[model samples]
Target: MHSVNTRTLDLNLLVVFATLWDTQNVTRAGERLALSQPAVSHALRRLRERLDDELFVIGRHSLVPTARAMELIGPVREALGRLDDVLQGSTAFSPATAQRKFRIASGDFVEFLILPRLIQHIASEAPGVMIEVVPLPANNALPSLLENGEIDLVISTPVAFGAGLREETVTKVSLLTLIWQREGLSPGRFPLDLYLERPQVMIEMHQREGNIIDASLRAQGLARRVGVLVQNFMAMPVIASQTGYICNLPGPIAQAFAQTFGLSCHQPPIDFPEPELFAYWHARFDADPGLKWLRERIKECANTSDE
Candidate 1:
């Protein structure tokens, strides 16, 4: 491939490239861009000649991207999205009119605490917008997923995400224990001895031991008996309601689960540092008006949840 300065590259060809990449057919790409089929083909030809690569080729009646095209697709789409946002300027966000699908990475805790309220807020305020909540990816993959626009936002522990990402404190959380009321355990009588003596149901979502509470216990040279290990916090209500095992959870989540399952919510025998809830996003989207709107709404919901 011959090297050419990007300054001389026709910007219109990039628009064509992005359209064709999305539509994958010359005619459909032309329809989207309001250009003739020949015009779209001509742009592709010029792009191939200048870049020295067949960016796309016909395969099973669809235009499939070549290796080079695959490499360029992410940047091309991102560039076009940024450009579009700039053209829209401050007029970019109108919640009622914007039909966007925002993907969020979250855990069951945040889902219980914030998602319902956020959905209600969106339904009344931005009926056209949609949200998809996905499970938190492995820590190593989160940064790249945010960078590549695979996910728009993440709501998780403050420590789980860092570097290259922007975050805001969403909630301040403390620990509480959920146990079956049928276990003959009084809320006031859950002292250190009984807290340690019970067979606890530990939630190790993603193979992690419990957080601050567990650490505090270990620091005191104490440990809770593990009766079961489960991946989802949503299961805590059922497990604690039926079994004698106590489940330690974030305060708000524990209260909600306790109410729903007729379980008892108690303060942990040992106090731990309060962990913060946070919402994280890639810095690349800092200037994006639509994402800003979404974040603002989430922040509003988080504030309300804390109340």
Candidate 2:
């Protein structure tokens, strides 16, 4: 690492460097930048002096970047991009006229609960907009994905991070008892003791911590005898319906699934975390008018959406 220079850096010079680095030739970079070749050359000289490094030197046909220039280029470009996003004034995105592809990382449960309504909203409002949903990876990749604009929105429980991301709870859910069928017990409502004593079914969304429900149970000084386990929450209704096993899950989701599958949702015996659904976006998108419009639309979709 070199010593930190106290002299102020020229923000404009960095743009020149980016263009020059991409073109590798002063004349072409100047053309791309709409500046005269000599003007670009003068700017480069100033930049080199300020940074105390020959950022680039002439080759036969193009300028080859030095190690230091390469090191500075990426961070400089990223910073400038962020600054540009910030400088943009607030404007609402109009979905009907807008064309965009919004990526989402979500569980099958979230998709099942929210996507149908979201798609309906998009169809009426953002017909040109596209959607690609990916299963949530068991990692903190959502933050960086948001930063890069790879993913537009992530709806889930809160995750820890600094200012790079913004999160807000859009809705809250209580825990519900999920039971498939009652061989002797008719499916109407479930007893709490039936949940604790009966063999439970669960799946871990985490890659490392096998079963999250089990861990949650242990947190409450209780553990379910997980009889059957599956990874996707969509399968929970199917599995529980046939096997008569009981599961504890988010109340709205449980109610929706239970109503669909001839199962029932009841209050649970023990205290459980109130599962919160969050809507989060990257700070990079804070000023994007189109993104701003879509965020409001999404929030509206969530509010009017059932379950």
Candidate 3:
């Protein structure tokens, strides 16, 4: 065995290896790679020498991969696939017939607002494409998930991602106060005094003991009485509906909940910053055609806010 410096290795050899791995026959592999049979043999020879292994051997009708070649094939194939994707560019993004999977990280608020429309659009137009929602706390939970290629995008309030990350505004969503119609709060508006006095149901987006709403309220030298705490925005309506508790939820989620659970939506009296949901990705994927297409679809779906 020899210690080969990868810096001096020809990447073309991996292509030869990949082509040979797929086709098995030297002639077929050479035809696929647009190389003569001799050129393919030469490339394989170099690859074998560099790796200090007989990567493949001539069988009756096909080349048999050595145990070492079998071990390297998976990563070699993956690398070549990624390289092909890169070389193909945005022109190859045909959602209609493309079979691809996208991983997105976001909370229930964003999911509740956009998933149905997004899913329907994908199902109707890009039947073969798939969307996987990597649940949050996911964005914060896995610090290196995006950088390591574990997830494609992050949809969240502009959080600090240090470097090699890019964020694009998906949508800005204003906060709305949600209360049961039975609570008898005035429609269209919630008075600050009544809001402070009412028992509130809080959605804990972060794992912290307190919520952003409480932090905002404290900044204004005021506090609301939170009587219950739920994990996601979806549960807020359920708790508020049955318990007559007021909850501060995103406008889109509140609107959906209002229609479904007979809840009332009111503009909060206190001044609060609207949460801008941003689509974040690693800088490496900034020019990726597939992710670009996915991002556009996400933006379309996220553009649900009336405000």
What is candidate 2's lDDT per residue for 73-185, written digit by digit as tens? 65775677777766764445777788888887777767766778879888988899988887775446666567656678787766665556777776665667777545445
Global fold similarity of model 3 (TM-score): 0.70
On the 0 to 100 scale, the lDDT of residue 292 in model 3 is: 90
Q: Write the per-residue lDDT of candidate 3 for residues 213-280, one digit (tens) a residue.
A: 77788998898886887777778888888888888787777786786887899998876777788888
Listed in order, each prediction's TM-score against the native is 0.74, 0.69, 0.70
Report lDDT (Cα) of residue 166, candidate 2. 77
The better candidate by TM-score, 1 or 3, is 1
Q: Report the number of backbone clashes for model 1.
A: 0
Model 3 — which ten-residue stretch has the worst lDDT? 136-145
Each model's lDDT: 0.81, 0.72, 0.79
Better of 1 and 2 by lDDT: 1
